[model samples]
Target: MTGKIVVITGAGGGLGRALSRRLASDGDTVVMLGRTLSKLEEVATGIGERAVPIACEITSPDSVRAAFAQIAETFGQIDALINNAGLFQPSTLLEASDELITDAVMTNLAGTAFCARAAIPLLKRGGHIINVTSESVAIPLPFLTIYQASKAGVENFTQMLNLELYDRGIRVSTVRAGTMVGEGMSAKIEPETMMRMFADAGKRGIDMMARGASSYESTVDAFRLILNSPADLYVPSVAFHGLPAGWTDAG
Candidate 1:
């Protein structure tokens, strides 16, 4: 990974932060893009000189284009791009307002597409694009209709984009992640509320594995495999942690 320049959106926190740190530690120059400059700087500082912080709003094409311009100016080329910025809001169909659905689609699906469109020009041949999607797309669990729909859109986009970019030697892949339990995630929810939600979900046989449930290292390893593989090598259509029986069409 040495000397390779990689750009990761939402690189200030969550999985994005982990990938930035890991890639930087592996001697790859990581460009961290996020809406918050301070958060991005914090990640960059922790990663030493191998990381660069760039303020970007993936929902805005101009912001994404400008950020890529800065990256081009600083790094000269981008070898890979990871579209990891996304939002997750669970709402039942009856209670899901237009605002909720719109936000999910705009951020998770549209934002990913925008970033990929902006990065394609700068990405080198044989470079890779990785989109982080949720396993919800497969199960279609209740109360997460919007999130599932948005992620399903991402999956479709990734597949079609791979074909469109095939002639240019770029490859596209996605990580269909399950629950991840970790420190930062717990902070986002009240302990009691989170516990209650989990308990209720369990009663209904709907398990959210929580953040940090899967080691961050495993996700990074998958990223490395996708990036290091030959351009013609095909990764699985979807990579996920767990699934109920008959969830996939093969069953």
Candidate 2:
């Protein structure tokens, strides 16, 4: 993957920042895209030259377009795109305020698609788009209806584009990741939402830590497997929690 150009959204912190470092270590030119330029710059500083910060608000199509255009002028071309920017506000549909609802829809659904659309023109043959989804859609945890809906939309988009983008020599896939807790990430839930969520999980005997928290390292490996797979092989969507060292057979 040396010299390859990879664009990652929400690269200011959390999973995005960790993933940005992975790409940098692998010798890929990582463009760190996020709403806050200062935060992106902070992360980029640690990564040095390989990671360049780019400000982008994925929810707005204009922001996405201009950002990609700037990337093109600066980098010449993009090899892959990782649409990892999202908002995960846990609340019942009834309890969700207008702002919360809008944030979820815009960031999770519209934002994901908007970035994809903005990148398509710049992407050439063999380009890839990897969308980061969650396991909550399959687990269906309580008080997360809105969050699940947005992720579900991304999953649907990934699946649909997998076939649609094939003719253009592009590949699309989704990582239905399980609960990931790490530096800059909080495992804590809101008081009201936590009570409701726990009550429902108890009834269903749902233990999220059942698989143990997925580490940033394992997730990076999972992504590497997908991104670097043989061009002859067919890579489908995958889900992962924690994978033992040298466990590359996970598909």
Candidate 3:
């Protein structure tokens, strides 16, 4: 679908930035949404005319509604809405701060729901809503209780949402995702927190620190493939996984 309007949250950096560039190259008009206008502008500048940058705090319903209204006026139609904005602050349930936990739920879970709801009226028939969720739901991890819990909710929401939106020709799907490598992976958590998690993992016979993240290109490619698939074919979801780049039994 050349020239399709694709709205992506968190398009300022990481995999979101990469996807914006990738989809734009394929003739899609990419609306880049992020909390910081400066960061969104930087990304839009790189993509030239094919991209539009708008400041939006996904955690706020009012911000999301206004952003989507602007998007509807600009494009008149939306082909896809990618919910990629996420907050990952790793900490055990006992050790995590209350604010961190609230932020995680609001940004990862509520934010996604807000975007999807706002985009519904603007969505063209046969539009797609894709949620980016963590692979930890399938492969359990420790010290990321809040992060995993929120993403798991997103995954569940995607499935149920599919049933509701099916009659409207709007498909809801998700990507069970793994960590991205280098610049594609943005860690909002502190180094000390990470160190503590690693230490705890080591004590439990797990070596999370040694595990490498997936490359940005591969992760983007997975998404691209899913989007490019024939509409006549039915695909519930895509598992865009990064194999344990350094997963070892040395522990």
Tens digit of per-residue lDDT, candidate 2, span 1-251 = 35679999988887888899998998998999999999899889999899999999999999999999999898777888999888988888897899999988999989999999888877868888999999888986888899899999999989998888888888998988877766657235778777777787778887543445666655887778888876666577888866444556666
Candidates ranked by lDDT: 3, 2, 1
Cα TM-score per model? 0.86, 0.92, 0.92
Q: Which residues of candidate 3, in runs, are more than 4 Å off?
A: 203-205, 243-251
Which segments of candidate 1 are over 4 A away from where they belong?
Answer: 186-212, 236-238, 242-251
Deviation (Å) of 116 in candidate 1: 0.3
Which residue ranges in model 2 land beyond 4 Å of their true spot?
186-188, 208-211, 242-251
RMSD of each: 5.2, 3.7, 3.0
User: What lDDT would candidate 1 get against the real structure?
Assistant: 0.80
Better of 1 and 2 by TM-score: 2
Candidate 3's displacement at residue 78, Å, is 0.9
Error of 2 at 128 (Å): 0.4
**lDDT (Cα) of model 2:** 0.84
Per-residue CA lDDT of model 1 for 24-50, tens digit only, reads 888899999999999899878878999
For candidate 3, the C-alpha RMSD (Å) to the true structure equals 3.0
The count of residue-pair clashes in candidate 3 stands at 0
